[model samples]
Target: MEEGIAIRAENICKSFGEGDSYIEVIKNASFTIHKGELIALIAPSGGGKTTLLMMIGCVEEPSSGKIWLGDKQVFADKWLTRETRKIRREKIGFIFQAHYLIPFLNIIDNLTLLPQANKTDDKTARAKARELLKYFDIAEKEKAMPSQLSGGQNQRVAIARALVNEPQIILADEPTAALDMQRSVDVVKMLKQIALEQKVAIIMVTHDERMLPYCDRIMKIEDKTTIFEEQQLQKNSTHSD
Candidate 1:
């Protein structure tokens, strides 16, 4: 793998069932996601978008092929390391369609809980959580419960929670699926900013074509294979210059 490549998958294949009942969801799918890039994954329903993301996140195993996270070859036909949970905790962050915050906890506590669970001291965890909240422009809502915030505000808090651990890669599954058009755009823009500012690789699975413009690149899966489509933003920039 290259020095700054955060994720690399080679000849990955995932299948379910056996013999006559077998079904291959991903076949020989391969791609590389570099640091400081926001990549969108798009495909039809049952097209294996989530399966590919799950494989990379170490939540699901590929039936065959190799997977690399950063410089480590973590999966080759089977997981190389037994510490999948630890790897997920330290190196990967996940954002889903739902905010999934603890309903009973207030915003600040919700953000601080995970870090505290990971053994970070309360003072440091609280400080980090506050810093992230401020960065997301929701610092004043620290005491507000999830139910009190607007959808966008709740999503921002979720993003803050995802970043609190400072993971190198963020795998987002349909993150904007529940938001309005404007809010969706805002969230995608925020994700792009986060990718560039933090130099973290973000692979987002989305069905919304309008959100593709905010991404650096797009990967579409079909028939168990993957294809890359560049955004051409740089091309337009050079032409405008």
Candidate 2:
């Protein structure tokens, strides 16, 4: 892995079942995500996009191969440590297609709960949550319940929640899937801004090609292999003409 790379996967393969009933979701896949880049994982349905993301997030272990997050080698054939959950909590953030906010809890509390549960002082967690809400332009809605917020506001709160821990890498699975076109663009733009401003690497899985323009790079999965194309390449080629 290169210096400052937030995630590196080496020849990862994930399989389920055995013999005639077996399925290989990801095959010999490898890639690296650098700090501060917003990348999109693009693939068709049942193409292992979520499987790959789950593996990288450490929520699901790979059946074979190696994985690294930042400077730590978190997986190699088997888990390198028993602290996978701790590593995930401290180093990774997650956003999903749904906001998944606690409906009963207000926005501020929703963001505060995880960090506090992780042993951050209550006051500190509250402070950090407030800061994140402000950063995401949802500070005024801190006291509002998730159901009270609009779709965009709710998603903003979710993003704030993800950032409250100051994680180095964020894994987003179709975060804008349920939103309208403009709202989807807004959410993805927010993610890109967060990646650059906070210097956090983000991998967002999406089937929407319209969102590709906002990504720093596009990664496509095919036959268990991953390929990348830098968005800058097109701009550079155009400028050189």
Candidate 3:
């Protein structure tokens, strides 16, 4: 793997079912994403943007391809190891439209869950959770239940929870979809901040064009393949120059 590259996908393809019922979602899609970058992935509904994100996140198996996270090859035709759950827990963070915070747990507890499951001491987990809450500007809501916080606040906590594991890659599926325009913009800005400050690679799946400007680059899924928009533009411009 090249230095600073956070994710690399080579000739990736995905399909569902088999024989007559098989449906292909992605094919020959290859791309590299570097650390400290926020990438917007856009496609029409049913266009497999989410599928590509999932494949990179290790939640969905690619029918054929190779995927590398950081410096390690995690998948080649099939997963390199069977411990994908461990891989995800240690390497990837996920955000979704629904915040998915545990309703019964307080904000602090929700954030501490993953660390504690990895055998981190309770005190250490609590301290880490508090630090993340403070970073997200929701320190005061640490003890609040998900119901007590606004949607945006809950989403903040959700983002904090994702970072509790300090993942190298974050796969966000329509994270700002439910928020209003202002809040959506705020969330994307926050994501951009996280990518730069935390030096994590973030792939955000979104349908909203308004959010694209906040990203460092755009990855478009069309015709069952991936395109890096800015790189292509740069290449074209260099030729025309």
Candidate 4:
């Protein structure tokens, strides 16, 4: 991997089952995501978008080929380290379609939970969480529970929680799926700012083509392969299709 490249996947292939029962999802896919960029992952349903993201996030292992995150080669033929959980907690952040915040926990606690599990001191975790909340413009909601906040507020808190761990890569799966167009744009803009300001590479799995303008690059998984497109190229191609 080159300098400042947060993620690099080379000839990655994933499959399930064996023989006649087998199904191949991703094939010979190579891509790189650099720091300070927001990338949009666009694919039809069942196109392996979430599977690829989960593999990069260390939640799933590749069946073949190599994958790297920053300076570490996490997978070659198999996982480089036995402790994927540790790598995941330290190097990756995840956002889902649903906010997935614990209902009984207050916003602050929800944000602090993962960092604390990673052995960060309570003071440090809370301080980082507070800074992120302020950055996302939801500082006043820190004391509120998930049930008490609006959908957008909860999503903001989710973004804050993801950052509290200071992850190098963020994997967001359909983060704006539940929101209206305006709110979706709001979330994507916030993600763009976070990527540029924090220098963290963000891969957002989105079905909404309207949000592509906010991303620095677009990677579409098609025909069992990964096709990369510059934002300008995407404009000339995707919308016309």
Best candidate per lDDT, number? 1
Tens-digit lDDT track of model 3 for 175-234: 999899988988888887888778999999998988887787899988999998883222
lDDT of 1: 0.90
Off by over 4 Å in 1: 234-241
Residue-by-residue lDDT tens digits, candidate 2, 1-241 = 4798999999999999999999998999989899988899998899999889989989899999999899999999999999888888899999989999999899888999889868999999999998888887888998999999988898888888888899999999999998999899778888888887788999999988888888889999987789997785332221222
Q: What is the lDDT, from 0 to 100, of the residue 239 in candidate 2?
A: 21
> Could you give me the TM-score of model 3 versus the true structure?
0.94
Off by over 4 Å in 2: 233-241
Q: Is candidate 1 or candidate 3 better by lDDT?
A: 1
Report lDDT per candidate.
Answer: 0.90, 0.88, 0.89, 0.89
lDDT of 3 at 60: 88
Stretches of candidate 3 off by over 4 Å are 231-241
Pairs of residues clashing in candidate 3: none
Residue 32 displacement in candidate 4 (angstroms): 0.9
Poorest 10 consecutive residues of model 3 by lDDT?
232-241
For candidate 3, what is the lDDT? Answer: 0.89
lDDT of 4 by residue, 41-121 (tens): 999999999889988988888899899999899999899899999998999999999899999999999999998899899
**If scored against the real structure, what TM-score would every candidate get?**
0.94, 0.94, 0.94, 0.95
Output candidate 3 Cα RMSD: 4.8
